[model samples]
Target: MATAGGGNAHMVFRRYLDAVGLQGLASAEAAGLHTSEWYALSLITLEGSLSSGELASRTGLTTGATTRLIDRLERAGYARRAADPHDRRRVI
Candidate 1:
């Protein structure tokens, strides 16, 4: 017996996800960054500067990955690590 499930549903869901992911990637490239770097930057830019640990928490990225992303941003001259006037030991 054939099931009554919808065949096109999966295609529609996948298309939606792909479309959103591609759009985000395109936006990242246009902003002078690798698509993989976009989420970190977007979080920082929208939420204001944050310590690497805090950024990692907000982005669901590990500390090391967040650090690497920050390094790339610095190397690209898109961002820089600054001393938090109140806490000279931390990069802001």
Candidate 2:
């Protein structure tokens, strides 16, 4: 996307993001995962563990949607809920 003299920086960056998003979708599809599931899994993997509310906040999903997402992942054998240990009321 760069031209002879460092050209089209904005367009180049936009295109790069678009390509990456498409690739993520394709890879998730190949793995039989929804795009949101794939992204949440990536976040969880990176963090090791986090609470359900945190997942909802980070993913910009409503609490209900996040819960449903977790349910799906659990059914698929990809995720599980665990107690926070520090907070009995919290699910991680």
Per TM-score, the best of the predicted structures is 2
List TM-score per model, in order.
0.71, 0.85
Q: Which lDDT value does model 2 have at 45?
A: 94
Question: How well does candidate 1 match the true structure in TM-score terms?
Answer: 0.71
Q: Model 2, range 1-92, lDDT digits (tens) per residue?
A: 34566458866987999999999999899989999999999999999888888999999999999999999999999999999899889889
lDDT of each: 0.85, 0.92
CA lDDT for candidate 1: 0.85
Report the C-alpha lDDT of model 1 over 35-90, residue by residue, as the tens digit: 76888877778988899999888878899988998899989887788899998998
Count: clashes, candidate 2? 0
Task: List runs of model 1 lying over 4 Å from the truth.
Answer: 1-18
